[model samples]
Target: MRTPHVVVVMGVAGTGKTTIGPLLAGRLGVPYAEGDDFHPQANIDKMAAGIPLGDEDRRPWLDAIGAWAHGRAGLGGVVSSSALKRAYRDRLRAAAPGVVFVHLTGDRELIEDRMAQRQGHFMPTALLDSQFATLQPLEADERGVAVDVSGSPEQIAARAAAALDGLDATAPDAIAPDTTAQAGPSPL
Candidate 1:
């Protein structure tokens, strides 16, 4: 049997992290965690009011998610987070050293459209530019795959799963250096 590694479904808001995380977890037979649930009311309020959260505001939230990821170590699980900045991902790695990331990448226009169309999400479409500005694509040294978000949720999840399957799960750093290039083009 293959060893199970926890997967962090990461990307900018509206890239379908919430949608894809659960499906990927089902495929992997692991529990799914909504990263936004870790946020304090203040953080939510800030975003809802069109304010982007600063690093100081995000530290506690990231720590909470990291704690959850740390607890799920070896048992396998899926969790969603923007994890846009390298520093945030580094913080997560500090807590759960073996966690692998699945970055859902998409075109700015598509992501903005999705955000605009979605209802009741605390993250406003107005904040999307800031999100794109903050995102740092997964680096070569990172243990992760970058899956494009140009398909249905099921298709994207499948792609993420297939990319993850290519990783050597037992290795400490299961890096996929060129997976981003392999994800292909945006349809719209």
Candidate 2:
């Protein structure tokens, strides 16, 4: 039997991580985890007040998500996280060594527009800039793929599924090439 990998659907706040995560999880027949649920109330309050969380503020949240990811390792699960920095991703990898990322990429205007349309979300549109500023694209060595957010959630999830399908998830150092271009138009 093939080993199943835990997928982390990652990107900036408004790039649709929440929407696509469950879709991808459904496609893969795995459970889904909402990363924001891992955040403490304090962190939500901070972001709600337009404050960007510092590394110290994020560590606990990341660890919480990591712990969940660790628990789901090999069992196959999908989780969502902004995972905007290399260090944050590294922290996740430390806890769940085989977790693969599905980065949702899109233009700022598009993301901002989507953020405005969304309701009852604690993350304010004001924090979008900070999210983009903090984002670090996955490196060549990273075992993941970047999918463009230009299409519908179903389309985006389909693209991610296709990209992930091509990856050798069992390989310790499987490198998922940047498939953003193939997924759709450049979101850069």
Candidate 3:
């Protein structure tokens, strides 16, 4: 609801953060910062070597990204990050309070296919598994929404903007709950 909202596009690799971040920023009429840009050369090299980045490797990067996000938001700008952990999210929150995170969730196979098909990216497909394994999905109680990456990039960006702007009136019928006790769990 605040001006220059920071909407983080968080998820494991291949979740479309890089693609959607700029589009979302454009929609919001603000600059979008990619979290990957904060990564040092060493981290990039390790990822290029098909090695997963551990917490130690990510701490400085996350801090730098968070600092940038905080600074930008303070100056009426929006930023995006692939913050994969609750702790990392907390760090960003600490830096930019009330920043809304738009979590992009997808299946391993789906995202793996995306990574494999991706062109001119330093992150190799081999590191996808490690990212998935280390990823901690955002909590349901968090101040953010989870959107499944089951549609086109445009659809995903629209959903993110709608959620952020409160312009989406119709509820997403992505799932239907069963009222009858006999009915089993509704398909999510």
In model 3, the Cα lDDT at residue 133 comes to 73
Superposed by TM-score, candidate 1 places the C-alpha of residue 43 at a distance from the truth, in angstroms, of: 0.1
Candidate 1 structure lDDT? 0.86
Residue-level lDDT of model 3, residues 66-180, one tens digit each, is 6776677545445556677777777666666646678898888899999889998899988877787777887864567788888898888888887866622333312122123
- Report the Cα lDDT for candidate 2: 0.86
**Cα lDDT listed for each candidate:** 0.86, 0.86, 0.73
Off by over 4 Å in 3: 74-76, 167-188
Per-residue accuracy of model 1 over 54-100 as CA lDDT, tens digit each: 99898888889888988998798999999999888877877777778
Selected candidate, larger TM-score, 2 vs 3 = 2
TM-score of 3: 0.82
Which of 2 and 3 is the better model by lDDT? 2
**Local error of candidate 1 at residue 180 (angstroms):** 24
lDDT by residue (tens digit), candidate 2, 71-114 = 99768899999999987887787777778899999989999999
Error of 2 at 30 (Å): 0.2
Task: Name the lDDT of candidate 3.
Answer: 0.73
